[model samples]
Target: MIKNFSKLALAAGVSAAIALPASALAEIRIGIAGPQTGPVAQYGDMQFSGARMAIERINAEGGVNGEMLEAVEVDDVCDPKQAVTVANRLVNEGVSFVVGHLCSSSTQPASDIYEDEGILMITPASTSPEITARGYELVFRTIGLDSMQGPVAANHLISLEPKRVAVIHDKQQYGEGIATSVRDTLEEADVNVVMFEGITAGDKDFSSLVTKLKQADVDYVYYGGYHPELGLILRQARQADLDATFMGPEGVGNKDINTIAGDAAEGLLVTLPPSFDEKEVNQALVKAFEEKGEDPSGPFVLTSYTAVQLIAEGIEQAGSTDPFEVAEALREGSFETPIGMVSYDEKGDMESFEFVVYEWHADGSKTAVN
Candidate 1:
């Protein structure tokens, strides 16, 4: 079930005004920020579900310090400009911590606000290396960054021995960063990066780009972008008889890609985080999703769960509702989460796991290839 926190209000002194000044209203307030209403709503929905599930499970077992966890969600629309506003709003609302601003573009700017406000922030799905490389004390992520995933995909492509590879990007930070990394890695491997280019996001026609690839005789095309543009590229390439196998980053590894590309989506390959379904420990999580009528196998669910668990553990260690103490706790140690053991480096970057290779089936289900 979907829940929104737009209407929640925090009372500054309500905790102090309680009967026992020592123990306040007993509500641990956390922020949930994401693209709750936009082209990337699915990502936000998956993230929100994981957070909700974690909170429900924790509450059922008795919340931390005898306080119930209350998450207030703010929609950032996955836009960088809007992200700053959302971050300020979350801070203004007196949330103890935050989990969101999903897109890398959004995460980058929103993180500054979090640091300025001394609020703890964690992103479950934004994988761009730049997001964490800033060395902010308050920012953290549950997933590995593009610095790892980009090269993994590049190495995979190089192993396939494609004669000529073409690279394209949506010109966004997340997309372009991954594409540049892949292009550099492929070049390092002495692979022919025949065409490296950037295309506008939300482009309707990729015929010109496809024609250029066909003329270059490219056997493989690597796209560092989200699913919608990838779908259009694949469909247009097939229609133009470009005949190149499409590859993309995890951002493009969604069932929605299949819906957009249909038959053209078949045989598409992508590099993403390791399969969550393959982990036996996540059976309960899968069951929880089913009980809530959500698909546990979705892209961001496991990571989202990990994010919430990370925050909850931090809260527990801090033994208080103060965001500063929780941030200190998170940076000082690791949390054993559903994704695995997650710990932060000095820069608040996670030294966690590697990305996985997957082939998107015609039906949109992914099969692990690596």
Candidate 2:
């Protein structure tokens, strides 16, 4: 569990902007839980930036019900065990809601604790369907699930009509789960799936994997994992002179991939949340993020902002601070958020969410292709 004294230590290496407003009249405390130090902490930066911005803006607008909101942040380091520890820390601090547990593996365990403890949680990035499939009233997210993302990628692949496709994963919950989804969808669509394999998450060398890909004579590769591994795979594959188009889910859609893979990152296809910052209606909000030196274009930023907005609105519509009432209000109402109109199904997932496919470039920018 992260203690008060270690907050600075956690922030030292992370690039996320932190804005914590302290009010004497703090009534509702929202716990921000995610990685402050980990391999995937770059994504955590988006989560923290969006939630902190929302908290700041909401408090500036006189808060909810005349009670100012407070923030209690915890670092889980994107590790499931650390997530459980931080979730318990949030529980002990008596936070009414949480905005994180970013990685799906971490979110699952932390959500189990939150559900039992009656803490309302809205993960802005964790997309494993299992998190919400258990029918937990408290678990919700601002992002679409692997079930939604996989088929989108596969359908796009089908349209391209590749001769042979290879699917790879990191063997973790999020990676393997989405990889399986893509494989299943491809098989159903009568596409030739040459291989489906798992790779170690942190492995640096992919020479052997490159050989396997070449041996399979695959023309396209679909990776289900975060950017780090995929970035390395792209770099090594480029060195080995393997010719194949690479596509991945949003998990591998970070700008850091450009840094890792260098020029090899160009032409990588990724399915991600729509560019909310690019929407005209959100220009002012995008400027607000820019003014504060935050990058709003990252996939999780606006979704996380919407998570905080939903919680605040849910509380107001319910006319109570009880998390149960807030949860019910969230499921029953439609919200106009930066992402778009959000209305939850009975399982607490958005009834309609859009995932756009983008063509990534080596300059750390992407253009929508589908």
Query: Largest TM-score belongs to which candidate?
Result: 2
- Computed on alpha carbons, the lDDT of every model, listed in order, comes to 0.85, 0.93
Question: What TM-score fits each model?
Answer: 0.92, 0.93
**In candidate 2, residue 124 scores what lDDT?**
96
Query: Model 2, which residues run further than 4 Å from truth?
Result: 1-25
Each model's backbone clash number: 0, 0
What is the C-alpha lDDT profile of model 1 across 226-280, one tens digit per residue? 9889998898888888888999988888888888899999999989888785699
Q: What is the lDDT of candidate 2?
A: 0.93
Residue-level lDDT of model 2, residues 163-195, one tens digit each, is: 999999999999999999999999999999999
Off by over 4 Å in 1: 1-24
TM-score of 2: 0.93
